[model samples]
Target: MVARDAQDNVSPRSSTTTVTTGAACGNPVCGVRQVTTDTDIPWGLVTLPDGSVLYNRRDAHDIIQLNPTTGVKTNLGTVPNVQSTDGEGGLLGLAISASFSSDRWLYIMHTSPSDNRVVRIRLENGRLNTASEQVLVSGIRRNKYHDGGRLRFGPDGKLYASTGDAQNGAYAQDRSALEGKVLRLNPDGTVPSDNPFGNYVWSYGHRNPQGLTFDSQGRLWEQEFGNSIMDETNLITRGGNYGWPACEGTSGTCGTAGFIAPVRTYPTAEGSCSGITIVRDALYVACARGARMYRAAISGSSLTNVQTYFSGTYGRLRTVEPAPDGGLWLTTTNQGDKDSTPNNSNERVLHVTLGN
Candidate 1:
């Protein structure tokens, strides 16, 4: 599976053969070994056109380039300073420029020195032009947790971001609050005129939505963290409200707020949702408490047949990114909490291109 040149220092090379169920003697999903590591507690991953993998390390607040093929690492440097925070602080999510073919920008969603902001930087030869970094959007609430800070470009070229409720459960329902909502912004970081709220929000009523992405058909979806029980997976739309502190699951109408219910949800003790990815026709979500991979098939507007796997082996699945070879790149989060030595056997990056 040859990939397009990774414009600039980015390229997605077809480094290995597809991992089928019975092909390799010992390994299947993860064919290549991890070459270099950031060791700052890696979070999300994005593969460049040249097969180079870009990842973010939280405690250090740095973005660095990793080459699974050669085991070489080049630091992209610390993200812009973030204010003091706990549980959900420092640097978080990342998004490669969809217009990288021309713009050459790499965007990051992090809690900045002032507030939570999405900033853009240039990656030259696998290094960030940190000095030129600038905030794309600002004034987002920062807190101990629920600072929903995930960013991704929709297939429509609009930037979709998820922000946590900053532990303030009610903010998830406040249309005026930027926290606890999924926002749609133009590439320049302005509220999209066609945005559902006619302002900065695209969808509201979310607790701590960490994962946001689009399926092949260009429909956007998100995975939300439930307070005690009932985590969720939702298909996003204009003006949609995903009941958070207001409603727990797909049970009620979310108090006539016209809530858009999740396609699937489960008890948090069994399934605390984290990262989410749509591969092929299936949606894959990472679980913290469940410590497994939740798989479901997308049927038009919703998801069904939800199942969980990968329990116990990997402590917790953090993020899943679309790969160039039709596979998905998975990241671990036991270290994401910023404590304990990384369990190498479980804390490695994996590429899974599935087949029978």
Candidate 2:
């Protein structure tokens, strides 16, 4: 770049410097619009092959199907026996079975009377067959807070889930404890023989990891909530240990051998990122306390060129998923955030589109 004066005298050319722009210049989220409103703390979001979306309310315990094309919503019956912790735990993540076309199974993670569990319910016709519910994974401890609940099936067709420490930080460091770990299991909830510990545990030492997604390369990425210092986004590995109670984000005992570090870290207040999804080789994370969306370019096993969008525009962003049409679906958790006194009935689902 060079500068020219009014007299048409051009200055010498400057050194080459590149400037990046949002979405169009390889950043994500070019434009976004409110697609549906009046939601109740919308939690998990998953898109079906039919272009319809299924999401559950964290506090209401009901699943709702949304026709993105029409903005029409259908109340798909609620899961029975779901109990809210009066804090963060309730009906959380949702994942569609790979054989949904034939099996019609929808998986959910929710807080129950005794613990947090993963169950599969049959979606017969247009409503859920509550009687057909089958509890697959159970015995995960729960608490008023820190009940990490996010479910996603990997490319290998194995079910993967994130569990919180149940406010007991020590549990994160114990491989034998189911709490605060990423668990892998067969679709039938059986222990996969190939699992690291010959049990359901896949990766251990996580605090409150709520974000899980597989990149195009089949590498798993997770986002975790920190105690007071840092929130992390990590590239998950099989049998990897993410230091939680022993470390926050590469601080405490993170430098020790065998402990993996996060690809990116944000101050707790600015992050608390919950849900994540990858679209067009870029990773998008919806943050709660920060009330923003973060977009990071995925560079082989790492994240780079990070950018923030809609900071404070939404009360508290909760979930983000790839839309069937190559866009993104985002949900807000404003109804329950005490910081904003958000209108209980004004929570929203947003449609976000990306550019080249």
Query: Which candidate ranks first by TM-score, i.e. highest?
Result: 2
Query: TM-score per candidate, in order?
Result: 0.87, 0.90
Q: Model 1: which ten-residue window has the lowest total lDDT?
A: 338-347
User: How well is each residue in 225-329 modelled by candidate 2, as lDDT tens digits?
Assistant: 988899999899889999888989977988988899999999989999999999878999999998999999998878989999999998789999988667889
Which candidate leads in lDDT?
A: 2
lDDT of 1 by residue, 154-207 (tens): 878888889998888888889988888998888788877787677888888898
- What are the runs in model 2 whose C-alpha is more than 4 Å off? 1-27, 338-345
What are the Cα lDDT values of the candidates? Answer: 0.75, 0.87
Candidate 2 lowest-lDDT run of ten: 336-345
